[model samples]
Structure formats: C-alpha cells, structure tokens
Target: MAIRDVRAYIEEHGLVETADEESEKSIWRKSGFEGVRSFGEMEQILSRFIREHRDARRLNRAQVGIMVGLHETIFARYERAFSKLHVTRLIHLCEILDCSPIEVVHAAAPHLFGDNRKEADDKMKLILCILDMPALTAASLLAMIEGLVGERERSGD
Candidate 1:
C-alpha cells in the first residue's frame, strides 16, 4: 500500500497523533535530536558510505544495481540522496556489497555507538580487528566478553 494510505489507516485507528496535532518540528524536538545532524546530512553520509563500500569492492554502480535488482539510475538516485534509502533497501544493498547494516549505520552516525566520537572510533576499530581475526580467536574473545557481561549482570551493573 502507498505511504499515504498507511498513514491514513494509522490515524484512523488512533495509532498515532495526527500531524495537525503534532508538527514535525515538535516531534524532532521531543525526540531530543534537535542539535544532531539533519536528515539530509545523514542521508549524504550514508550515501557516501555506500559509494565507498562499492568502490572498495571494485564494483561499479551498474554492477551493484544489477545485483540489488534496481536500475542503475535508481541506485544512483540513492547515492545522490535524491531518493531516501529505506532500511530494507539498505540491508539488501549491504548484503550485495558483502557488508553489514550496522557497519553502514556506524559510518553514518558513529556517535550513536558510543559516549563520544573517539570512543566510537575505538569501538569500531576493535570490531574491525575482531572481524579480521581467525574464527577460533574471535570465538574465544566472544566467550570472554560473554563471561564479563554475565558477571556484570550478576552484580546488577
């Protein structure tokens, strides 16, 4: 169904406040993201991440488009931020590029992953290191982390 139809259905069912009752600006302010990057800026960042991943894989836009079952021009629109990249489409594109959605999100908004930019970068580096490790070594690291988490939970941390 079209977005408008879905919206209308939701409003009709009182699932959410109508736009008339809650403006977009109010919603944004209420969401506590007023000073964060704008949607357009985030979109551009995500688009750049997509392009970089494609380049790193040495694959052209057309090749990625074919793999993701989108027309090259349509995919280009996403890269140009002319069209919004839906989450499902992002996941599909990440799959085609042999990358994870979390990686793309972290690239776009590292601040979401940690208390500060440096912390986020360090976490990303550690995650990349783990990803590059041998399977057994990674498994051992996971076990250690799980044990630490269990201990923390036991202490009500």
Candidate 2:
C-alpha cells in the first residue's frame, strides 16, 4: 500500500498514538502476526551494517579511523557498535565506505524509510548537516526524543 494509505489507516485506527502495542495488537488480530522491534534491535541492525560494510570494503578499523580523522581505538569502538554515533560522523563514515546514508539508514530502519525511497534519500542529505557530537550527546538527544514522544502520547496531539 502507499504510505499515505498506511498513514490514513493508522490515523483512523489511532495506532500511532498507541505506539507499537496497540498497533501490533490490531494487526495481529487482523492478520496472524505483527513484528515490532525494540530500540536495541534497531541498534543491532545498524551496527551489523557498519561492520559488514567495513569488511566488504576490506578496511580495518585503523584504516577507517585514519580516513575519518579519528584514532584507531575510537574507530574500533564504532566498528564494535559500542559507540553512540553522531549523524555527521556517520555521514563521514559513509563517504569513506563509498556508501549512501539512505542505504545504511534504510537497512537499519527499513520499516521507517524503505517505503518512501525519495523521502529517505532527501533525509539522508539533510541529516548530513547535523552537528557532530560525542556519544553522550547522542544519548541525551535520544532521551529528549523519548520525552517528546511521551509528551505527544500524553497530550494526544
């Protein structure tokens, strides 16, 4: 189905307001099953993508770090998925790997970015301009996002 149709269905059913719980229940009742991922699941997907891309390119952590102006230890942490990635650094990593942000993001969040290819491509470019920061900042940003999501849920707006 088109994204518009899916959005209309979700709105009509009050699914987005309910998060995955209500949506999954309704989908499972209608169909046989529904799959929902936790935040860690998405993280793992993204981590695996980075690791696989590095392996495919035959680039070691040290090599990637040198290319990206980071130390080998820091880059190793990123490769191991132990570091919280800033979008700007992720963009640089993509450039070094000769890959697209849209590709990586979509691989990590297919349910979100896959259906809308053009939109994903546009977002990839726009996010490149986001400021670089450490993992702690990324964690804080995630917390803020969760807070906003909670507020939206509570306000039902």
Candidate 3:
C-alpha cells in the first residue's frame, strides 16, 4: 500500500495524533497505503511550510530572482500561486530541507509520484535517505513544493 492510503486511513479513522516523532514515523510502515485523496493534502503541507518559514514568504518573481540569482520575471511566473516550478529552482529548495527532489515528492505525494511503494514505503523513508541534504539556505525548495502542489491543483484529476 502507498503511504497516502495510510494517511487517509489515519485521518478518516481519526487516529489520535501522537507527539512522538518516532511514533509518527511509524505510520507509513504500519498502514501500507492503497490510494490517495482525490484532493491531495500535499499542497496543504507545502502551504504550511511557506507560512511557517519566515524566509519562504510569497514574493513576486523579482524577489525570488534576487534570492536565487535569476531573472526576476522568471520567478514571477509562479507568483500567481499556481504554476509548476522549474527543476533547477527545486534543487535550491531541497537544500533548505537538506532534502532531495525524491524526498519532497515522497513527503508531499508519495502515492502519486513515489518510486512504486515496493521501493518507497513512506515519506519518512525518503526523508531519512536525504536527511543529510542540508539545512535551509535558499527558498527554492519551498517554491518547488508549491509548484508541484499547484500543478496538481490545476489538473483537478
């Protein structure tokens, strides 16, 4: 099962939220997902990250350009809060979580994009693999997360 499925079961069943990060870590391992919500929760988490992180605030493309050393308008295209991000920018974003592209997709949408649950179990598995990536330095990763979520939202599949 995919981690997405387990997460749904958790939410639908009202599984008591646990304080132990370790216990939280155990969710994907135990549930074995089957499918994910039609309206993905991945974006919600990404939005949370941007809101939680001071540096990740919404900036016009120009501000992001200043931050990432790119053409200001290049970043602006995504300012509407509904555009897919460029991959290069995504790499910059991962550096913040000390995370990887793989980690971001897994955490945010494992069932939709994970390497087949046979290979990927949970978001944590991916996070653990990239745990040593690097602490937040650039706002790129947040943007990438936003982009993916935005893309999913647009499709409305």
Best by lDDT: 1
lDDT (10s digit) by residue, model 1, range 17-101 = 3232323642221111224555677788899989998999999989999998889998999999888899999999888888878
lDDT of 2 by residue, 1-157 (tens): 5565776776664443323432444341111112455445556677788889999999888888899898999887776667867799889888888777777766666445423556655665545533345678768987998999999999998
TM-score of each: 0.71, 0.52, 0.34
Off by over 4 Å in 1: 1-23, 28-34, 150-157
lDDT of each: 0.78, 0.67, 0.51
Clashes of 3: 7
Show where candidate 3 strays beyond 4 Å. Answer: 1-64, 70-80, 96-98, 112-130, 133-157
> Where's the lowest-lDDT run of ten residues in candidate 1?
26-35
Q: What is the lDDT of residue 35 in candidate 1?
A: 41
lDDT of 3 by residue, 68-95 (tens): 6767565444433244445666677555
lDDT measured at residue 108 in model 2 versus the true structure, 0 to 100: 64
TM-score of 3: 0.34
Is candidate 2 or 3 superior in lDDT? 2
* Model 1 per-residue lDDT at 7: 57
Which regions of candidate 2 are displaced past 4 Å? 1-34, 113-157
Candidate order, lDDT descending? 1, 2, 3
